[model samples]
Target chain A: MKLLEYQAKQRFAAAGIPVPPGRLARTPEEAAAAARELGRIAVKAQVPIGGRGKAGGIAVVDTPEEAQREAARILAMDIRGYPVRSVWCETGLSIDAELYLGITLDRDRRRLVIIFSAAGGMEIEQVAEEAPERIAKLWPDPFAGPQPFEIRRLAFAGLKHAPELHDRVPKLVSSLVGLTSRLYEVATSLDALTCEINPLVLTPEGNLVAADGKLEIDENADSRHKDIAEELARDETGDDGRSGDDPFEVEARKRGLTYVHLDGDIGCIGNGAGLTMNTLDLVKQHGGEPADFLDIGGGANAERVHNALEMVLLDPKVRGVFINIFGGITRGDEVARGIIAARDELHITKPLVVRMTGTMEEEGRKLLEEAGIVPAKTATGAAETIVQLTRAGSA
Target chain B: MSVLVDRSSRVLIQGITGREGSFHTAQMRAFGTNIVAGVSPGKGGTDQEGVPIFDTVADAVAATGADVSGIFVPPAFAADAIMESAAAGIELTVCITELIPVQDMIRAREFVIRSGHQLLGANCPGIVTPGQCKVGIIPNHINTPGPVGIVGRSGTLTYEVIQGLGQGGMGQTTSVGIGGDPVMGLSFPDVLQRFADDSETRAVVLIGEIGGSDEENAAAWIRGTGFDKPVVAFISGRTAPPGKRMGHAGAIISGNTGSAQSKLDALTAAGADIADTIEDVVRLTAVRLGTQPR
Candidate 1:
């Protein structure tokens, strides 16, 4: 669950981290009111995605009238796929330097990592590649908070050339260390996957403030954080209880099925995660674009299979459906019955190529043949057939 | 002759009274796994499926001498269950539950490794020795005892590879699913090293997906260690879009990292035969093992 910038900044400020005073404005009037409250302001488009600054979603204005104009302009624009619903009017700061500070779990290393760089305002990956030496990484003891010395070493390296800023750097580093510890606690308590503060700016007054913030909590941990979950639900769905959510995905989740919407014409459904991924790969390899990734999981009956098919057919882009199920604990015959039932009920006109192997596959194939759908003998053959069928249909 | 669990290994099922636990316990017992006892908190002194029940792993171990634990507990309690099993000095613990918080797993992993007990997965299919012993939920009927060894980060896809091998008359010595979680007990190289030492295992089939650097690390290990056995590899999620989680929590492509193509290239460059599909895995395994493909 990705948090909007306003939410992230709110969390950051509440954790005792210094942030530019900001208020979320939903309209031009609200923007003007906020601008009046905070003289010089930065009207930032409140969206979940990055590159908002480069996309012209952020506007710096000196007066209330200018702030309202900028807010109206940003609100009318779209960044990536999301519409700019609101703008964050924040007090514009006089920054001396832009630095980076982020705490994220390194999935490969299986440890908590803190990334700090003197060179900020660009993607961390680019900084890592272009000037690796400027960035300092520290793997802090998760059980024991990061020591002051460890924090100082990374922070001092960024401000090493300036002898005048040496005294303030330690204070800044200590404060950052304190902020990071609190941030880690918040992340652990909420089971957040990442907490990032990019371009943590340094002011001439020797103050460090977070200019931008991003927090992504794990969806699986949402149940444990009910308030956060409810908050996100309200924000995403709006008060009217409807948004740009895919109906198929919403229905699939309700039915306890795993479904991901994707672009392309081939609807791929398989029994397991590995097999489903392999099915999608094979489909694309055979020149078919996979419309979605769906895993029906183990032991599916007629009703579940019907649900799976209906979800696939719900996507207008899907010209063909590929059901590549390798039944181990899942019985193939039952799956076949579900597919046929869904096909009949939904009045599906799209082509479906199935490759049902293992555990009573013959019975499943017999049922498919009876329904005038020929099952492929091999996984590769099924993938190829689906691609060909979709191409033929398009032609 | 098998890696990890064998016929003589006494097995205890955690969360035995739960729906998934009860079903898999029967399946494991049916496949000739030594059913010693079960552990479900507050359900001790009772029996489920003729296996004696204990409230804790320590009690179960004391009574049944069960050295291996197959966890079927819910995600919330999975970490504690793993730690409990490790504290009891169980030699091998296989966790079938998925979606345990990564933070919890890190702590649990540290404890398990410190205790010298191996943890397989928070989300995994467990290990199986064809016609010998079955631990978790991999369907036992598809396997046959032979020379080829299989290790994977997936459940049913590994099963598919095993089935393909069986269909092509290439039976397996042992097949291990290292689990799909980002943090797991044993990795591809860990299982690969064990397979290398086991004489019953001749050729190996490695199934990897587009996530983590496990496959690349396994390849590097293979190259460095100079393992002589033939290894065939199959990497899934070649078509997976970047930043999309593909069912498994750990199986996602972030930026330029954890791509299937990168994993495949690394494995191939390290001298592992790349199997384009499950059927291709069968053919490659047969060729590597000096067996005629059916």
Candidate 2:
């Protein structure tokens, strides 16, 4: 759900907020063309993570040729584990003064805060660490809009030789707040976890612009946002880098489940997202690498369970499959039935470790045993079993 | 004799027609909750689990005299749903819907505060007075009515701790999941205040995760208020690396202040009896509350 900097700026421009003219380029040729259009530009790598400049992702190039060269360098690079897929070609701006503006959820106060500073182009974290006094934060009145006077004072304190920019700063702040509120609305509407615009910049020409943007929509809320849901579905269908043999894995993906192909050889499946993640962490903690994060949700029937086991065991790297169920709404007996059904249908060659809790756990365990699968009594026991299986080279 | 709700509390379920709403509603009813009315626009005049269905919260409240509402509206309309309940004069509104936009929550929270209405969560497990009323989706089987008041942010972790309490034969007065969302309706301090004043609640069990300053703030308040009741605390995600965001949308520890260690230190410094594990929480709570072994 994270929009690249260029995309966010485009959104800001669409909302009537003045943003520097920018073009996104996936290739060197596109970068050259973008640079030609912008004349003098800053070629910046388009990575979702921050600290791009310090990581040498941003370069100021005077000509199209230089812009293309910088774009090539950036696109070929991986700044912070995330590979730079494209470069943002933006028009270079005259600096009368630099200032920062952003809006984010303030969890402690249980409100949204507008953060502003005269020192733009610096990370907000750096500002907080070094010159905390320079930064001015304002909690906007939800009923009455952001106060101009409060923003003006903040801008005046953060910027140098920008008295002329003072009047426009508050106006821009109001607009930024409005944009943030709108973006938040869109994000929530789409079930996004976060939508952020960092280093909302102000230029010498008294123009305000969003320098960077990051939006991460919540996957849980995807069912409500049809547009995002369709996009996700399309993304899944179009992704075919890994194919064949892993039919169970393919099936799981088709069913809208996240199935990561890991080398650690332990296939981990669970009912809840939190439990799955914790199980993965515990597996890692216990010297076992989880092959996948497969959450069958709270209502995984017999068919889904069979499909899940097939998917996990299909991974060539998987030597053992671990099924952990903390049954609350979904009874343990249902999970047990699924395991039995899947075992009957699928050729699961790998050793299976099942840890079932809550209602009908004993019944579930009995069913698993009847199906020739020994169930682990505890989560720790299951995790240990996976580790032992992988270490002993026994499937 | 619970903090927020008990057997006599008449509950109304909003968004009762939806899948999640209906499922949890059935669970609550089975757990012996006084679920008098169900509300869902246009689905009104229909019945859910034999509970009388109403078009609006007002109608549900008017007919059933239900003062407490458990909301299951989706994230998109959750804010509006909360506002409706608040406007309808519901004294306490428990919103179980997760992933509500921060803006919507801000507006909903402001409106609730302005109108003098109390709201619980936009992403929470709801409140449960063990052996009495179960509102929201906290599993009823894991809990039992006792003398301890429990408050937590995470759902499963709270369940684990409560299960531990149950296993130790230490039932709870009321266990409230304040929710793991960034902008939740109720804070730890807010719930702790209620627990402090409640005569039936002899002790408090606080379950916190790394992220927001809610724990630190609660620690300060607890220190300042001088609540005589013993508090046993367990902070989860301690092994969670700094800057690594958890599954909860609100679960992110950005700086040093919001780290698990810092929160744990704060709680410890505030005189809260610390428990390393779920079982340890049970043992500490029993010892602190003078609940001897059966």
Candidate 3:
């Protein structure tokens, strides 16, 4: 679960990471009041995902009236697919230099890496690509945490060109290292997957502050962090920050199923994550683009399957449906019942090629046969059938 | 002998009293796995499926002399469960749990590495030697004993590929699902190395999805060592768009790295036949082994 910028910054500040004071404003009046107190402020759209600045979701204003106007404008606008529900009105900063600093789990290395560069703000990746030498990376030991020397090394390497930043940069880097240590503490303690601070700024006052923050907690590890879970639950009740989630995805989550929308004609559903991905690949290999990726997961009951099918069929672009279930912990018979129920209740006329095998296969196949739904013999065969049926229909 | 588990694999299920643990435990027993004991805190002294339950992995290990552990614990306690398995001196530990925090796994992995025990997955389907022993959640009936050995990241994709192998008159010696999490206990290279050593595995089928450099590392190993076995490979998520987590949390294309095209190029460079489709796996396996496809 991704925390909104304000939420991330709040956690960072609580962890002793210096951050520009910010208040969340839901209305133009609230924005004006916040700007009045802060004097010069930046109104940032409170959306979970990024690219807000290019989308005109960010506005910098000096006057309270201008802040209110910008807040109203941002709130009424739509950036990408997300609606601006709230504005993060924070005191604007005058920076001596912008330095990029962040820590992310390098999935390939299976370790935490601290990424540092002189070129900060957004476009850190672009900097890494253009001038690789400017960026310095350090892999911190999970147990020992990031050491002061390592941070100084990375800071000196990345910001060597700026002679003015020599004395202050080391201090900033040390604070960042401490902040990173705190971030790691929160990550391990709260079961967070990622904690990042982009553009850790060196102010004209020679103080360091995290200009932006992003923290993503692992949703599966929610049981361990009750406070965070409660906060997330409370956030979900209101607009919070999840503004652009498709209603279908939300419904699927409620029903204990996984769904991802895609731009294709064939709807694909499978019993496992790997199988679901393979099903999508198979669909494409057989000359059909997948409409969505849906995993019913193990031990799914009739209702889950019914809901999964219903959600997939909701996509009008889905000309054909393919269900690839190799039931192990998930009983084949329950899946068969769900498919039959979905076919009857939803009145699904589109072609559905199901290949159900393992764990009560006979019973499941019998149910499908009785429903006049001829199941495919193999996964590839099922994909072939769905592709053929959809192509034939289109022709 | 199979690469990981066989009739001799004394299997113990961690979190055995839980829903997934109990369910797959029963499946493993039915598939002829030597189910020796189970471990679930506070559920000790209780018996389920006629197997002994213990309070700790150490107790379970001491009582049953179990050498292999299959974990089905929740993500929060998954790292502890793995550490427990390793601490108990289990030779091999297979974790079926998913969504373990990367930091926890990093620590767990470091601990396990120090302990010198092999960990299979934090989100894998485990290993199965068809008609001999089955561990983890990979469906038991999807496979049968043969000369082909399989190693993969995704559970259901492995099952689908198993079915494809079967449909092509090829059966598996042992199919190991290393899991689709960012961090894995046993990686593609580890599994491939085991498969190469096993006499029963005349040919190996490698299944990988987008994300991570495990496949690339395995490819480099194959190229460096000039592995003798005819390894056939299939990479999923060719059409997967970047930034979308396709069911598996680990199966996402990030930037220029972790692309299907990149993995395919690496695998091809390492002298492995690529399967574009599920059916292509069988065809490539047949061609590599100098046999006619059924």
Candidate lDDT scores, in order, read 0.85, 0.75, 0.84
For each model in turn, which proportion of the native inter-chain contacts is also found?
0.63, 0.22, 0.76
Candidate 1 lDDT tens digits, A1-395: 77788888888888788899998898999999998999999999877778999999999999999998999999898776677788999999898878888877887677778888767778888988988877887777656757767877767775564455667776777766776676676677767788888888889887888899988877667678777667766666222122345676666676777888898989999987899999998988888889999988766777888888888888888998999988755777999999999888788888889998765688999999999889998888999999998999999
Q: What is the TM-score of each candidate against the true structure?
A: 0.92, 0.84, 0.93
Stronger candidate by DockQ (1 vs 3): 3
For model 2, which pairs clash? Answer: A1-A215, A2-A215, A118-A158, A118-A159, A192-A217, A192-A218, A193-A218
Q: What is the interface RMSD of each candidate, in Å?
A: 2.0, 4.0, 1.9
- Predicted structure 2: lDDT: 0.75
Which candidate ranks first by DockQ, i.e. highest?
3
Give Cα distance to truth, residue A106, candidate 1, Å. 0.9
lDDT of 1: 0.85
Once superposed on the true structure, which residue ranges of model 2 sit more than 4 Å away at CA? A81-85, A142-204, A209-322, A349-351, A359-395, B242-244, B255-258, B292-294
Clashing pairs in model 1, backbone N/Cα/C closer than 3 A: none
Query: Against the correct fold, how does model 2 do in TM-score?
Result: 0.84
DockQ of 2: 0.34
Best by lDDT: 1
> Can you write out model 1's per-residue Cα lDDT over B267-287, one digit (the tens) per residue?
988899998888789988988
lDDT of 3 by residue, A1-395 (tens): 77778888888888888899888898999999999999999999977777888889999999999999999999898776667778999999998888777767777678778788777886777987888888888888777877777777876787776566777765666666676577666666666776777777878877878888888876666566667657756655222334566776666677667788888999999988777888888888778999999988767898889999998988788898999998766788899999999999999999989999977788999999999998898887888899999999999
Tens digit per residue, CA lDDT, model 2, B123-215: 777889988899987776888888889998876667767777887888888999888777778789899999988888898999887777888
Instruction: List the DockQ of the predictions in order.
Output: 0.63, 0.34, 0.69
Task: Give the alpha carbon lDDT tens digit for every residue of A1-395 in model 2.
Answer: 44556655665566555667888788989999998888999998876567889999999999989988889998888765566767889888776555666666667666666666666677777878888876777676666546556555544555433455656755655555455455434444444445555656656555666666655554445455556446434433112212332555456667656554444678888765455655676687787877776767545677778777877776677888888887655567888988887777776656778888765677888888888888887677788887897778753
